[model samples]
Target: MRRTSLLAATGALLLSAAPAAAAQPQVRIHDIQGTTRVSPLVGKHVADVPGVVTGVRASGASRGFWFQDPNPDNDPRTSEGLFVYTGDKDPAVAVGDAVTVSGVVSEYYPLSSGETPETTANQSVTELTGASWQVTGKGSVPAEEIGPDTVPQAYAAPDGNIEKTQLDPARYALDYFESREGMVLRVDDARVVGPTDTHRSLWVTTKPEQNRNPRGGTTYTGYADANSGRLKVESLAGGDFPAADVGDRLRGGTEGPLDYSSYGGYVLEANALGQHVPGGLKPETTRKQADGELSVATYNVENLAPSNDPAKFQRLAEGVVRGLAAPDIVAVEEVQDNSGPEDDGVVDASQTLTKLTDAIAAAGGPHYQWRQINPQNDADGGQPGGNIRVAFLFNPNRVSFMDKPGGDATTPVRPVADGGHAALSTSPGRIAPTDDAWKDSRKPLVGQFEFRGAPVFVVADHFASKGGDQPMHGRFQPPTRSSEEQRTAQSRLVRGFVDDLRRVDGGARAVVLGDLNDFGFSPALAPLTDGGALTDLATTLPPAERYSYVYEGNSQQLDHTLVTPGVRADYDIVHLNAEFHDQTSDHDPQVTRIQP
Candidate 1:
């Protein structure tokens, strides 16, 4: 934590020493102690220690250069701002570069990370900052030191040794019998065992529960006998078997006969598990013709990117205004705002949505107003060039906005433990962990509105997470500790919110909508469903049309519209067109007509 001021005059040494240089100072060190540094380090000794290059910004009017190095760890010892130096140099620096310098370390006072470092604060530079000391040619190492030249071999299973197994009703427990924690095996013929709990259960006669070793990377599948509920077959591997209904099958690996009582049950990882099959629904189209009836819809719009420019932020307010039949309210998720310097002057997403509201007005639709919760700049994930978010559009004619809301509607939304890691692991079109800025960017938008003369509470949410083939950290079925904690907290918060709403009007009519970021069958939605506070209308639609987004060419619904039991009979939840998967929107607009 070197705290001092970096004087601009400090860089004068390298600038002056350059012309009459003897061997040309090859190394430069611009100490970023308390202020900004601005200088070039082509052939100077440049030094910086344990810092992340936030970015490379060009200096003003002079084609000069400087790099931003922010302290990655929240350490008080490290300074924040740009380190600058000067010399006739080509440093070849890039964003996210980490380096160490051994030149004079100076401090600059009265500066901030907000403005350019050198211009606002004291700056210093070492004459020999970035000099290259040594050069090595290719193949310089001894052949023996380079290691063996043999091609790595893979273990090939003996022919006909890979066996497939199926389960029958009488052998329902067999699925738990064959799987072992660390050995990767395949399962066939598996079906979703139960919706018994919020964590959807997948039952496979040939698959057992696998749990990760809390201390190491090993995994195991555990078998428990039905007769005594005692553990058996701690680990099993080598084969392709399916765990499904009596006849269905799929292949998967096994790693555990986990201690069910100690760490809950063993988690099962399906070898070739398909997405959860949507539940059956009674098909009936019901239209509302009441004079003041309002049709509201909420859609997740999974990774909706402007055509040809997946990362570019396109304003959808116009499409939302013009594409569908006029609805009183529409809640959307994954709205983006590309306003940063990184976006290269593309349309700001917030501006785009603003235009969408204007489009609604222009289309002779109701005068629609909108609200959104923008995550902190650091919170970004999901798709490239897109900032995932949740927003609400309200028609002034149908509902009047409350001047001040009760809850903090702008906080970053948290994910439930079960859904967190899985959701964050499978965000499309972007790298994981690195692109986790928007992982919790979404927040539930709660507003008070008049629903047909009666005041109703409308809460729109976009839950934390994304889709993933494997659990967080490749932990077996269920999920790992980290992912589970996040999702559990998320669920508790949502449940608390819903409970508060019920207490507001003695459990009056309420509607919850948006991309919950979980399937209809996920336990995350249990609070609303089990409490009978909300009705899941998405489950009432056919499977083919139920999915709002597709992954690996398979369709699965993540968008939803739910209403309270009090008003469930008064409205018909309709799953509109979803067949046009990639055309208008990734999610099909769900239209719900509620009686006034």
Candidate 2:
């Protein structure tokens, strides 16, 4: 998706000159392209360029067509193809038509206009603006094939300097996109990684044997190492493209004109797409309740608010009741303020909870009671006005919440002895709320509960998101994750709290569970696992079934349930979401059975 920015400046490259009767000089497409990403002859008028039409798009902010030279020069960095932008006017150019075009060269940046605007410099698409076209002949245009087999591994260099990336299509994805920009690309038998975006952009990987996770899906191991095989296919030429899910395959091949967009990075503007082959991953069956076992699940409901459709609340209730087997307690994250996304100084979410709990009862589930500490106004980071925070939903009939006072947004909860038993000073308080590590992120919610006369302490956390982290396929070779440091400190704080409980009572049962926002294999998680105070339950599962989230065709874990010693736990990562097209969240709900 495109980041929010003002439109970029579009210079008048084409001058209104009188029609010339004499034949204009013919220039090769590569000469106008010059060897740099920014065209050398930008703002200069050129004429009588001959090429065969490879693809055409007659709609949207980018209304144009693509053509490729029949013959090319010696410079591999110079592209053989070019785009002719008609600017809301129809050029009447069809695919397979050999035509001569006369126009001024220009560089189009999606968002570089206005007084204070943002532009993707050195990444703008070069094109022929305000162009006039004449058909010379009609014939078939062969497209440049791009797949795992066609692209050379040697050319897969590193991404950075535009000069070095001229022909390094095999080593880096950005280089590959630049080298083939504005040309027709054909991908045969590619696998879909990410689902279609709002602009109908589909991400796919040419290498079916790409480095996969233990769950038979892709994983983000490193920067270039993880995303060298993926590509984004955008269909802005109009008409609906079929929606796809992770692990789905595109059979019969997909072809499109390669172009650049500010939001989607480099994309193939598809006029046609192949048939969608399903991944055969179905919804999971509900978990069965056992006699001596108490089920606790953590679900990130994805910013649920009172303003959302009542039907949305109903669907979530069904998932909680059916998919999670009506767990005795659910650590819910992303519960928004009652006013939803509207930032009106409203902080309480009692109305939001009322609607959700009402739906659970109507769906034949236990009447669940929720507890949470509302962050001051916009203290917790998430949707600006939404005031998203972590909460807990427990069945009052099954478990009793030990109610105590002294809990608020800024107050830090500490472990204290209650009737000779280890307990929290505040029943449902925040853990290290004022810590610098949690500057603007969601704070951990701690609670004390008694299930069947056994005391259990729980901490529900929603850590800092990976928004500012460098992408897996960025200019840097091994991209740096700026968000990891904050998450590491937060993890250590939570681990320290768990260790505190153990110090009070050697046989204390504590659970730390929520959307951790860090991978199970990442070094960022070492602080929580290194000391052995707690163990991530995902480590106990077979590698093939350890994931709780599916992203870019990779089965990974961003949510986890870590427990202390003497707490025998059995967890099931429900696959009702992530792998399916219809999902309330990108993460699958996970249920853990704890015998305290």
Clashes of 2: 12
Candidate 2 lDDT, 1-596, residue by residue in tens: 11111221112222334455666556878888766677778898887788888888776566678988878777666788899987666656778899877788987765533312132232567899867766789855566777676544332344443433345554545666676777778888777776664556667777666665433356554333554566778764466676777677788768877887655456777766777887765577556768778888999999999988888898898888888889999999999999999999999999999899889989989999999999998888899999999999999988899988999999999998777779888989999999998888999999999988988888999999987654443333345687999999999899888888878887888889999998887777778888688889988876557777765445577999998877898888887777656677777888899864
**Which stretches of candidate 2 lie above 4 Å from their native place?**
1-27, 32-46, 73-78, 86-92, 102-123, 130-134, 151-166, 212-217, 221-224, 262-264, 542-546, 550-555
Best-performing candidate as measured by lDDT:
2
Best by TM-score: 2
Query: In model 1, which runs have C-alpha deviations exceeding 4 angstroms?
Result: 1-289, 301-324, 338-349, 361-364, 384-386, 405-439, 467-485, 542-545, 569-578
CA shift at 141, candidate 2, in angstroms?
2.5
What's each prediction's TM-score?
0.44, 0.86
